[model samples]
Target chain A: MKIRPINHKKPSKIRELTYELKVEQVMCDDVITLSPDDTMNDVLRILRDNKIRGILVLDKDRLVGVVSIEDLISCLVDKGKLNEKIENRMTKDIVTVYSDESIVQVVNKFEDNGYGRFPVIDRDTKKLVGILTKGDIIDGLLEKLEIEYRQEEIHRYRASHIFEDVISDNSTLIMQYHIKGGDFKKAGEQTSKLRKNLLRLGIMPETIRRVAIASFEAEMNTVIYTPEGELIAKIQPDKITINTIDSGPGIPNIKQAMRQGYSTAPDWVRELGFGAGMGLPNIKNCSDEMKIKSKVGKGTDLQFIIYRRENET
Target chain B: MKLSRIIQILDAKILCNVQGRLDSDIPMICGSDLMSDVLAFIKSGALLLTGLTTIQVVYTAENAGVNVVCFVRGKKPSKETVDLANEKKITLLTTNMSMFESCGKLYNNGLIGGSDYEN
Candidate 1:
């Protein structure tokens, strides 16, 4: 369960790591399929009987459509679609797989396109071949977990070695910046990078997670509404502390911001399907201690700390 | 459909580690386009609807202890993402409806918020 420290040298060259992960290395072949000619009766029967969410649609023995429980439910509720054609009802313009792509490519496909089931087809024949379901993707993720966790453990071990040499009577201070507002794509960048650094530093796992959550929230909040903020972390011998400072439109009501339903995100953020306004709440939930300061016109700052484990010392 | 029923309906493979699979009937499921809100707000067993396709989505699910994720708008995950769900025992599904339409349909069909039926 030891994570290997990512060779820090590799980070600055993230682009170089792009092609490292392969697709076939992670996809699962165990998937289910349904032909396009199939009826709602058939699809619903399968969905209901099997307790599943989706069915791949094949036409002329080629991958064509995908049907899901939600689709069937919609049909049944309307009451006019009992016998409607599945091709008409099913979702078209489907995303597919060739089995030869990279794992990152697949991951990107899932993220960008909103697909969890892909009919793996032969490039030439284009047949409705093996199905790739979300289960298949989940399998891929878990595999990465092992790989990632190992790397982290290794990194932690190396960090421990470095720590021994440093003989830190105090925690190191990591200079940080508030994440820019409206930068969803880069939301996790700071935290993920910090996590890797911490792993390599051999910080305790529990402490690492706490820091991760706190940093992650601050990063997300910067994007949500702050317009700008910096998240600074300090690795002290006794505890870890993170401070997020921003200068955007500040929270008029910290109490309301702490509530789960309270959010000030725009329509686009919602369309991208987050900003349910849980960032601050989750941060508070994860951190052992939390502090927030804000001025209406001056933006906000979030400070949180989690102590080291007793046995680790 | 209930989460348990969805599992049974799909004969789905449980790909994540979960403790209470049968305690509640999942009605009124909201499908989103993001992974964060799903992780933060949605309860356990509430089937996720999102258009995002990534290992991070699965990671979010695993971290949140969620059991199932359904990609709508026909978003298909690659082998890597599928593989992650399998290892986590989280059920991954795909659908074709857009965010708004999908939720409306599910909501209309008794995937009602806070509506838990025994069936």
Candidate 2:
């Protein structure tokens, strides 16, 4: 790979990029909210129709509690609670994020609480302005990484004989490995290899650390969930990318899988000290870019990238 | 704090010798038996003190960048746990102190929790 010059002077640029990613920039402002008086039946229909897990319990424009599918499932067991008002069953202690808050802080909250989603309120007005999900943060990070990668590409192009070298010697180096499912013994093998390669290439310690965590999580996901999978690592001068493609019972609900604490692993897997449903979230947090696509009964493809030259401090 | 200092304060037994890693700096201590919670909040190079005595704890600690694990309340880990800890280069310790006391001692010794972000 053609290495690029490390920009030591603009060390704060990376931090500036992350801190500028406000909750509002990535939040879904057009939230599907339900009034407190709405019946559980109404909540059920909305959730089913939208393929969503939860609905915000709003009192007009004001923020309130959240009622989720778990609540509905428990209420269904009682049968008589079907017509009960959502306010009676909704969770009162709402955990929320402010629109102006940095994305890093939002990620910290997600890690600390293990919540699937959070209501985003205006800092000044204290009114519910949007809803932020793990998927939103992933998308935002992916966008930022893409922009940074493109800029790096431009720099590489300017620094070299662009078209001819691009055709003769591709700067990106690719390596692939096959991982078998239920192979807990060999779970982190590829991650260790990737880390070694990055270290040999002299990547920054912090960047290598994030890459190690992200690759390990993705590798474990494949080992725990799929029958078999291929892990692809691409090393570039400016970034390191890992792609996990698995063939197995695909995740039916990608949204749900992205949520923290949502795991489909068997109980025995939890005994292995995994399956807390933090794998994907942890991967997203460590990566500068992440994308996941899955088809029911088909397979899953997960891709994440970490910038090699990012500031450590 | 150093791992040696942690061992001294907790009156722990080293189950696995990690060579010079005992002299490595530990800025944080997280105590939890639930591997999920540990994975969620652990920082790099932090010390993990848990009551969980499974090989999975060692695996979790390895994945989360934790280099030292202390089993509290005198809980003994399996042979597989110690073996994995050795392979992964993670120092293993066993202490008779309760989880609360172990954490308190570390905190009293200036090893802080990893949650530095504002709540």
Candidate 3:
């Protein structure tokens, strides 16, 4: 019946506000509790069945502790003790909150207290009522953000959108990219940027994924093997294109490079631990359309395209 | 401990938004020296204390959405790093203790490691 002025919640339409206001208006009222004696199998099943991150451990009617997924993993992996009694390893120190707390206070409790999930208890009853998860918070936050984004779609400057500007209304543009050898440090920067731009343009998620995978591979190639190179990207309403042009010592044999198992990355690079040599093939695998043009002296250029579907195009 | 308490515990100097308004009561923590291992294993908002200070330290923290970074053992970051940390607005803390020692203190004082996200 009354509207309370709160902190700087973003201004939005009523519909937009509702999407972000994911916190339970009535306060979360469901939580799972565990007795220390609950077995590993029992707890595991609870986690699986309820799809909960953690459960509160209670001794009689009083809360004594908590158990989580990572705890179970440690018991199973390091100690080989999962089959043993669960009570012995269950945490005695449980982090929790009262149901009356504001959602912001609940969020603040997540970090200040240092636990990612908490048992929500009805203070008067001291009864575990529900679980609060960091994922839940993020889910709420993302909902708020996406709602905000949908209201006003805007484009920002980025290297990958170069194609977006050049492509004509009637024609689609596409390209592929290759990273020259010895450019490892700059790897993924291009594809990563491409991913950002696509999201900003409000492109379909799947289309962005395709361009991301292709560009990532090409960028890695330039860094791992090419002496000099640049990633080329093309954009069209019908399709998004990306190309990797490398002037490095070219792939001596196209067939060998295309082979899935063929890799030429150096040992030192691998030791720091990267470069499986599947870079090009992986890119090829991800693109809707792919082509490789390589010459021994001139180096390599890769072209890949992801077609935007007709209706959404 | 409240985040303010941690500031007291380590005699740590906080950079950016130390206006006695920061959240210090961390429910869980993950301590690792190798940045990648921490990135792969850590949950969305754990307090991270490590010995490394590469730019990827900020990068990993940003992606993981880690709220805090405690640079242990007299490790001072470059000015560029502080700028990055500031830009991201994530908490940056400095303490003069070895990784093992710092972690042990926090653990002994009751900080849980690992997250619950069971499903």
Off by over 4 Å in 3: A1-185, A310-313, B1-119
The TM-score obtained for chain B by all candidates, in the order given, is 0.71, 0.93, 0.86
Q: Model 2, range A221-246, lDDT digits (tens) per residue?
A: 88888899999998776777889999
User: lDDT tens string, model 1, A1-313?
Assistant: 1212232223322322223434455544555666766688888777777776788776655667888777888887888465677887888988887766644455556666676566666667665446655565556656666677798777667666664567557547565655777775555667766776776766766666667755766776677777778888887666788888888788888898899767887776666545667778888877889999888898787799888865554
Give per-model TM-scores: 0.48, 0.56, 0.41
Q: What is the lDDT of residue B27 in candidate 1?
A: 55
> Any runs in candidate 2 off by more than 4 Å, and if so which?
A1-169, A311-313, B21-23, B34-40, B53-56, B117-119
**In model 1 chain A, which range of ten residues has the least summed lDDT?**
A1-10
What TM-score should be assigned to candidate 3? 0.41
Order of candidates by TM-score, top first? 2, 1, 3
Which 10 residues in a row give candidate 2 chain A its minimum summed lDDT? A1-10
Query: Which CAPRI level is candidate 1?
Result: incorrect
- For residues B35-57, could you state the per-residue lDDT of candidate 1 as single tens digits? 66555455545677777776657
lDDT, residue A210, model 1: 60
Better of 1 and 3 by lDDT: 1
Candidate topping TM-score: 2
lDDT of 3 at B36: 33
DockQ scores for all predicted structures = 0.11, 0.11, 0.02
Q: lDDT by residue for model 3 over A49-139, one digit each (tens)?
A: 9887677787788877788886788788876555555687677777777766655566555546667577777778876777677676556
